[model samples]
Target: MLALLAAQLTLALLFGPASAQTTGAVKLATFKGPVTPVLAEYIERAIANAEVTGAAALVIELDTPGGSVDITKTLTQRMTSATVPVIVYVAPRGAHAGSAGTFITLAGHIAAMAPGSSIGAASPVGSEGGELPETLKTKETNILVADIKNLAARRGEKAVTWAAKAVSEAAAATADEALALGVIDVVADDVPDLLRQLDGRQVIVAGKEITLQLSDLPIETVPLSGIENFLNTLTNPALAAILLTIGLNAILFELSNPGGYVAGVIGVICLLLAFYALGTLNANWVGLGFVGLAFVLFVLDIKAPTHGVLTIGGIVSFVLGTFILFNTSELDVPWATIIALALATGGFFAFAIGKALAIQRRQPTTGLEGMIGQTAEVRRALEPVGTVLAEGELWAAESESGPIAVGERVVITGHDGFRLRVRKLTREA
Candidate 1:
């Protein structure tokens, strides 16, 4: 029995628990990610799958640096009241249940963590990752304290304070401390060990404490689908920002050079996705406005020659807006992204303005300006000036040399109002 207990303890230390049964024993699904919409969706789907399969319970493997307080609460409720028992295991070494993760772990029917794992830090804040004001923080702390306390009440008060400290002081206790304080029920070496240790442990489930008979239960790992992976990838903050940039550029490009539906279509798609992501993550609208203002400055600079002053302002606004948009609690935006956008934006406007100036300096090619290079047949001969038919009308013209013949095609070198300034196309031609 001593050796058996030691062996069981080892298995619990690891998330890789042996199959509880040989066939049709239980279904264990896994999802490890941030608390994003896609993750929420995957959890909901896993719960549904567990119900359909008639499994004993579903185990959710979690490892996240808390996100969106609202989403955490929702996931907590689902775990606590799941029709099938919900086992939330904060698994693998070095994993943690910070902020929202504390609530989730406590809500589970059986909360367990691997060695070197931790849980705590359930403080709440606004969506932009800023600390809530003192008053709001107090209120938020009180609410979360009550929440975790209620869950911990059935377990113990020590667990309750630890839970609160997790959010209040950003406290984190190791797996050993957590188990000792009753914050977690078990600390197995791995999944099989967890099962063995839990084979007959009495725990309250749905208001009834029953020994879980999970021996010989087969465990199947349900992973996120391909579609879910794709959605999750798009939900990244950086990716969303990139999409926004691409979409905005595409639409602007199409506006400058119309008649191409492809750019417009892609722009619309990317913009829609960017809006959706920003909405979901609850981005600061002020930052968004700043980004808009930056673009406005850019367009204004393009239209009116500010001699690069507006362009400089536009670049500064854009860089600041991009940095502010993401709400980084860490090391701000990537230097590479900023450098690339600055170089690209600066080059774009400078090149455009240069091209416009070049066009201005070039010789005229339309209307009266085009009559300069043209040749015409003199209706009557003259020493210097004479009436000539050219450019679809008869005009008074002059030649520096001999008169030209009729029906000759000539280049329009210059134009002055109604006069036809004619010249031969080429000496050889």
Candidate 2:
């Protein structure tokens, strides 16, 4: 019994540290969209959680077309300095790490890609998606090139050169090409495969070199919170443009016929949401101005009887505005959708305003003015002024042609205050 106890103690001491090192779970998170502030927050939270939980490593499955540069910088900085090793994998067969995505992928301690996935295209453009002015473009491009070079340095000179070309010329590479160029360390088929490949890989984490023991570890997926999901949806450029259009039209409808607060409330809500989205997307203010002008023209057409001329101009302005609003190289806003929405909005307002004007031109149907051209029975003889039944009520009336006798029918020709002017109805012989 004494010998057995001594052997057990020796065995525990020999393997305990190795077993403890591999006990923690691996953390996983998916980021499949533009890089917005919400995405940055979510990643930051995930990293913090991993650190708190003593996770073996944090894996970020990324698929994005790109997004705000400032947000991307924030994410890269956080990821590069994280306590736990971060593995950025471009996954799901055909996903591409574009523009800002390139910076993030390179920032990871272990950069990887799935089979058939791609990376690169890190060119810097204006915030509004247009080419920057030459001098500014040079300055911004140089800054980005320097940053990317640093991120790719550990991968070797080939990767560093390719990364610079990606920014200067928008160069892209497939998974196999990236692996050959040393831009990525591995090409995996899926998450499980990624872990298998990443096992035993050495990575630098917070200034210390560590080997990943990721095989067979439990993976805990971190999902976006409700608020994060909602904010992510607001990052869509097309959705923002549509919201702007609907909000303007609704508010205009409420202003034209202001009674129920339903349209007005809905309009305000939609506009607020749209503004949030536009601000996130860095939409062109000139496009917003055009949209506002289009609505203004619509109101003018309704008020000033412009014979549809102003309405046509409003339609043109609306289409132009929508096009400009979503004109970003990072996002592909459908032209067909923009044109269709503009035409529909313009046609609806034109028809609505036309109907409203027609109603206004109609003769009065109920009031003193309504009594004109109406037939009435003479309740009392009219010696130029007498009481007569008009519209089921007795009214003092004056005869325009001559004195009207009692029990005779008379027609109201006009009204002065409450007195109606009447003329005896003549029966054609």
Candidate 3:
């Protein structure tokens, strides 16, 4: 009886932890926007955590227009090889897994979509959103076709054919259509509905087949870290452009009026972040050059008297550059934002020029130069020199015309080392 008890205890010790781990809560993470490196890291972290906890499944609520191909490959490889089952759900009614997003959705152990959601449109385009050259297009399309076909092969031949077409022809499908084509496993209304439908469904994870018991499992949400969120925000084309503009202006201001380090420091930080976003988005160098030229023109307008001509040119260059900067099929900046920023920049420079012109035309207000043109009252009579009350102070003065009587007004013509040269004021009448 003691030996039997020992065997039972040994069996319990061997299987208890495994059972508990397999029955743990489900993990959910929401991913929205472009599939950049920051978001890639977030998804990787979530997958790792789910594997460590032995959760029932890791559900990624996906909403993206897609992004970098290299990053997409990295994400797909990670998801496919993850120890935990990964479910890619295109959710919240209107989301679509386009471009690189298509590969990521297909790489999931279980793919799902909500009503009105779509999938596909995985064709490759140039960094600037134009069609690739013939040679390059053929090469890229073939490789992508092969990769996507492999990912969709398990679904069926129809899915494989459709996946190839998605890469080659840029085909897309709605949730119902994808489900009918076997491209997706289910069309769920939401997370809860997804779990309910996926429960008892068997999926192959990391080469091991297991049934997902998600219906009864508690769901725990995993949110992006603060740094991740900030980096992700920097990926926005409009925001990045705005940052670049502000950074350049701040740096210019610091250079023009040096001393305080606040503008310089902020400029550096913003520039670095903007550059990061630009690199991630693959911005056109020509567009950047145009933007730089616009600022140069603005500075020139301030230094040289152009009467707002250069400012107008700068506004045009700025608007054109901004449009070109984000002229990609997937990344488009709003025209209103670009126009407004350009107008505001032009107005600011115009105001600065107005102030500069005013200063140039105004008379000096200090020192001997400032005292050259003033009216003074004679306090003492002078044959050639006398004391005069000038600028509310008594000063020794020499008369230029002739003898000037006391209380007579004189116009200051010049100064001679603490002495004022004056002439009698002629009555205008």
Candidate 4:
């Protein structure tokens, strides 16, 4: 054992600096949008991947507005307990780590920021998506402030104070300001510069100290898998709303037409995706109810033929419903998308209703009912039971009053099984 240890020490002295810098690797993950459940899952997966690959560190490039508080808490826990160092880089010019992003940045094993980037706004919002009422807001703010303070304590007194202020007042600072205040360790221009600055930095991983040998190490950017990417995209509130509306329209069209499997299938799939997104977002149920009501009005208008009156009402309902569907500031559907969907929905139902009315006005072409009110010629004298030609087909006939002569013009009044009920027409003498 002593001999092996001596040999290893000799080799370390010979090639330590050069090999250490060149042999290290980094696993990079970029989060460029809101912090959703999908994002949290992605981070966890990326961290596991990095650990398995034996990478020196996992660097996350983050830029986000905000997202679910529960998801944010899960992410913070993951970051603090990661097997390897977690470096959170708030990147690029004009980018921000807002709300939940602030919590994540502060939780990093080694927090960093790129030039021009800012971080803050850790306030917790109400279920309605806006600022909580005074009492509830105070409670929520206190909870978040305490959480932030704990995360920032090791950084310094100034960082701890600023972190609490960020939760309470939504305070923000640029990269330079953050660095000066010890909110972040370093500010860099880009990833390469960040790695350069990160080389030889001491960080703790799972309670054990580790030094990052990041200089010139190869970086593998981990991206979301196909399914993850699709699910993550669904978390966009605007896209989810549009998808729901489109899905409903397709279902209604299929219901009105019947026998169209394609529309129904597509509608169901889209609705499933929309519902999944809504679940992740914790969307308001009352808003969903209003949207559902709008669709019901649209369907009613099509069935009852209301001369577009109900369609107009449907449009108003849909627009209003969409406006409130994601009432919270945290969950937003663009007004332009809502207006476009409302118009499209109204027009689609209006066309369907118009077609329904047209069908109602047309003469019946096929069915036993079509034979009624038709002029038929008596083939044989009807002694209450005889034969007649109607609709180009010979049919057994029954006379209503008296026997009818052959070639006499009769009006078909009704049908009883295969026999036609007829009334002879009297010619003026």
Candidate 5:
């Protein structure tokens, strides 16, 4: 009985769980634009989920101009440590993985590119835009070179040399060139083609050699959650700027039209999103101050009724602030967008304030104040107080002069509490 039990235990240990050994559907994640910390988090979650589900491989459809260096490092580490193969594919033609993207692409277990895609330019720069101080520049460049060299050494010597060149010279290559140079593994047309080419290919993952079994497997695309998608969109400099301007203006409009909840709610949400994006991008606070000052000027002009003086100053301040809002060359707020926003902002405030003034000058349309100058018919004789029909509703009306007969038309003069003060209308020569 002991011998039989020992044999059964050995068989079970050799086989283990079938699910853990067998690959499921291919897990896919499509990432585009500037890589961000949010994106890194998304990728991390994806890898965890893929591992849990026994995914055959995690295919990342990547297209980026680069992103945060720290986040890139985190992302690459996650990819390298993943239990399953991580394939980074620069896809859809005309796409190039530049800057931080180069590091991430090279770090993949199997790097690929669509026929028309390209990769390179792994240069690192300060999170704050522009050239760093000399000492800092050298230090950062050296650190990045060492990092890329380490990643490249896994691929081979030629790859290491090319990667070093990418860092030092911002070298780039087409898909064909990348494959030829051994910078990448494959060049295929699309995801399906990529899978076909990858089928039966042996690769080392998590320090163990494994052959891919990706043939005819279902592709499961992992998508960003609603909040993640929203936050990701906020990373765009143009979108962030537009959101900030619109949000401020909306809140200002809400103030101008007091007691309005819709504008205020939307404004607050947009502003919060803008602030979150700005924080992620490491925006200069001084620029924000200038933007705040611009809005203040606008509000002052609207309130004090300047002859466009403050508004003009506000426009200038807004343009200046927008130009300096973000501190990165990779992410620039377009001048066209800024100018358009400035003009639109000026026009929106002008129209909003103008309409507000016009409404203020106009007579009241509802409420106790609105009842004045409106005609009412006496429902019951108004000796002192009686019911009268005004605005299609009957109200208690007190005669201003003498008794008002029933069915006589009277003009509403004013109101106190629920009662309307009325005067009888008479023909005059």
Candidate 6:
């Protein structure tokens, strides 16, 4: 170990100031955007990377408008149970650590923030999708409050008021306010400054005290790799919603017009993706039931003849179901998307119903059925039987009770043997 350290130092020295700045130094992990599953995986990967690279410490830079409660709690657990000391930093200008982010900042081995950054607003918002159930809401709030308070107490600080306020009142505080309230440990201008500030700080990691030696150390930005990037892409709200919509549409299209291989394959693929996202999001099954009910109603409206009345009911059900579709404890669903889908569903049904009704009501203009009730010309001599020209074709004709005359206009009264039964036209008739 001594020899390895000496060799590492030797390499750093030979490489001059550039490499000397980074040898056996701090590694950084950054968290931006929503508190998604990809972010959780990224943090785990960062911890693993730190262990393998033997980094002195791992600093997680965070900036978010909050995220899912379940994911946030999992991330918090990772931070609290980390092998290498985990430093959570709310960074840069104009960044906020709100809602679930507040808990994350507090759960770190050492919480730090940039001078202009802020944290708190620890209220439990829906999984960024829709409102949660009342029972779930109560249970989640109580549990999260307890957990955050426990983390705070273990860190040897006042946590009761702050944690309770975050959950109950949706409290928020600036960096300076957080430091004043002991919500965070330190506030620095930048990463280098943070390192300088954290050089002698003692933190408990894996239940052991580790002093951070980060002063003047070159920071290695350990970002999420390609696989992590792909996973993150999969967890994106837009992408997930798109998969969900495509899956739903495919299944609906299949149901509307059954026995198609292409639609089935596409539906299965999209549904698989949707299920993956739903699992990651910890979505509520009840919301899924609502969506299913909406689909059922939509199908019923299309299949049954309700004269568009069922279709109107279907639109209402669809809108409500779509809004309730993602109401879960773990993450939020996009409200705008739900609204758009409702509008789209209404439009598609309207157009489809209009076409179907028009087809039903259309006047027949061709074939034998079309010639009935049309006026005709007498073409043959008939004491009571004669040929008549009707619908641009001449055919044998007869009158039921009287003889018809030839070369006279007549009115078709009925059909008899591929021809029209007509009565001769009188003057002004």
Residues 1-429 of candidate 3: C-alpha lDDT, one tens digit per residue? 999999999999998755765698899999898888999999999999998887888999998988889999999999999988899999889998998989999999999999999989999888766679999999999999999999999999999999999999999999999999999999999999999999899888777778788898899998999999989999998998889988988888788779998899999999999999998887877788889999999999988866688988899899888888865656877888898789878887788789889988888888766988788999998678999998889999999989999999999999899999999999971
Evaluate model 4: give its lDDT.
Answer: 0.85
Error of 3 at 217 (Å): 1.1
| Model 3 accuracy (lDDT, Cα) | 0.89
Model 3 steric clash pairs:
none
Best by lDDT: 3
lDDT of 5 at 241: 95
The per-model lDDT (C-alpha) reads: 0.72, 0.88, 0.89, 0.85, 0.86, 0.74
The all-Cα superposition gives candidate 5 an RMSD in Å to the true structure of 7.8
Q: Pairs clashing in candidate 5?
A: 129-327
Per-residue lDDT, model 1, residue 112, is 90
lDDT-superior candidate, 2 or 3: 3
Query: Which stretch of 10 consecutive residues in model 6 shows the poorest summed lDDT?
Result: 16-25
lDDT of 2 by residue, 65-94 (tens): 888888998899999989898999998899
- Tens digits of per-residue lDDT for model 6 on 46-107? 98887667777788899987777778778888777777777889998778888778888888
Over 4 Å off in model 1, which ranges? 1-24, 188-197, 225-227, 307-309, 328-335, 341-358, 374-385, 389-394, 398-413, 421-429
RMSD of 4: 4.4
- Deviation in Å, model 2, residue 42 alpha carbon: 0.4
Residue 370 of model 3, lDDT score: 93
lDDT tens digits by residue: candidate 1, 1-429: 999999988887663322321123556766565577788878888887876666666777777767777787787777777656677788888887777778888888888999988887666777777768889889988888888887777678788877778777778888999999989888977777777777776666556555576666877777889988877776666676777777877787788779988999999999998887777666666777776776677667667856577778877877777777766343134767866776687678667667767777787766666455555666645334556777568776655455655544455444456655555456774
After the best TM-score superposition of candidate 6, give how far the Cα of residue 275 lies from its true spot, in angstroms: 3.4
In model 5, which runs have C-alpha deviations exceeding 4 angstroms? 1-22, 256-262, 284-290, 303-306, 327-330, 333-336, 352-429
